[model samples]
Target: MKIDIAELIIVEGKDDVSALKRAVNADIIITNGLGLTKERLKEIETIAKDRGVIVFTDPDYPGSKIRNILKGRIPNCKHAYLNKSEAINPKTGKYGVEYAKPEAIVRALKNAKATVQDGSENYTLTDLVCWRLAGADSQKRREALCNHLRIGQANAKGLLNKLNAYQIPRAEIECFLAEYERGER
Candidate 1:
């Protein structure tokens, strides 16, 4: 028996469709990677108005880009965050929702969060820079932080927005950074 998801799940490709189908029952729409066109977004918006949407793309740059587009336009779509660690294909060494385990996919869907602008900027650009979450040599740190926060990987600006939009406190980021620096994370 599979889990029943009420929202329309959006993913990157057919492999993602196959993978998610193995995990749950839901209406799915494939964007074919970074190919989410205006027409497609319109279609998705129409469906989302009826059943809502869970944007569950791969845990990579392109995936993040796609999710961002949908978020900007749809405004209310739920987002699933599959850590890159769990989404990597062992043999191919590529990252995608298709590569993630069924359990991981289900877990991500179950924990999906809505990205909303609550007008709370808990952290700033300077904060990310001082915390080594931005600027040179910050990519890996950002990736690890996103994985820890289960908010998916993002570039500098996107990371800052997520840190604020998710309503994660400044103290939490500070503690996480300290733990990370101490190798106790």
Candidate 2:
């Protein structure tokens, strides 16, 4: 089934392009792994300016790094995130967009989030700790929160940066946490 998509998706490699093809019908540009050249960046910038760009990289460190680089160059680029667990193939023990199910890929694309580059700080480290999203023992909690928020997994500092970048309100976080607790109970 061919699903129509308007934006151009920026992926890591050919496998990602193939995986995305299984999910939706859209244009894609491969970054050819992490070694993004200036020419490629220029092309990406041109495409982004023309048809818009959605940065959908893998859930690993390299993926995040590439996404960050793209974001720096192309502000306001939309971001689609898949949880590491969702992207990991249990049989092969490999993690990538190619390993994610079609439904997961579609959902991530549909729920893509845009970065808020405004210089405004909403929450602090204290807030993260209070919400059980920081410190050594908060890994599980952080993962749950990230999944619920569709923010993907991150360490304390990274999560904080995401919170700030997304400009998520405190009340919204509290409501999600309360709902999560109710579901857990």
Candidate 3:
């Protein structure tokens, strides 16, 4: 089933727009790049005020930079995350939303979460270590956890922040871990 998003979706470029079109039924705006004109920013800001915005960028450093710029300006904008693994183009070794399968894109957008300014911390570093999502021999574990959680890949700290920002419950984490332990993943 195609997901329908009311918010104006923001992406990096034309290809990302095309990919989103295949995955969802929504209006989209392309940022083009870091060089967003003041006028364009104003336009987007106005649109954001009228209709909420969802920042769905590539899962890469440059994409993160663009997302950060938008986040700084539009604190209330929701965020959709594609796992780095999902966004990678194996043949070209490129990483972007354009390379992700339409199904993956749909899944990511479906999992989009609103940022909570005054959120409670649901998990801590100790929890990450106890869950085997941090420290040596934990890279693969962390990746699996992030993919399963659909929050995108991150270091221990970022993962913790997302766990809280997305308001994911401690019980949910425990349940997922329990399933993972049982090889039900």
For residues 14-57, could you state the per-residue lDDT of candidate 1 as single tens digits? 99999998988666889989988899999898778765899998
Indicate whether candidate 1 or candidate 2 has the larger lDDT.
1
Candidate 3 local lDDT, residue 46? 73
Query: Candidates ranked by lDDT, best first?
Result: 1, 2, 3
Which stretches in model 3 have alpha-carbon errors above 4 Å? 114-185
Question: Each model's C-alpha lDDT?
Answer: 0.83, 0.83, 0.79
RMSD per model, one decimal: 17.8, 17.7, 17.4
Ranking by TM-score: 1, 2, 3
Candidate 1: lDDT over CA atoms?
0.83
Error of 1 at 60 (Å): 0.7
lDDT of 2 by residue, 84-121 (tens): 99899899888899898888888898889432223335
The CA root-mean-square deviation of candidate 2, after full C-alpha superposition on the true structure, stands at 17.7
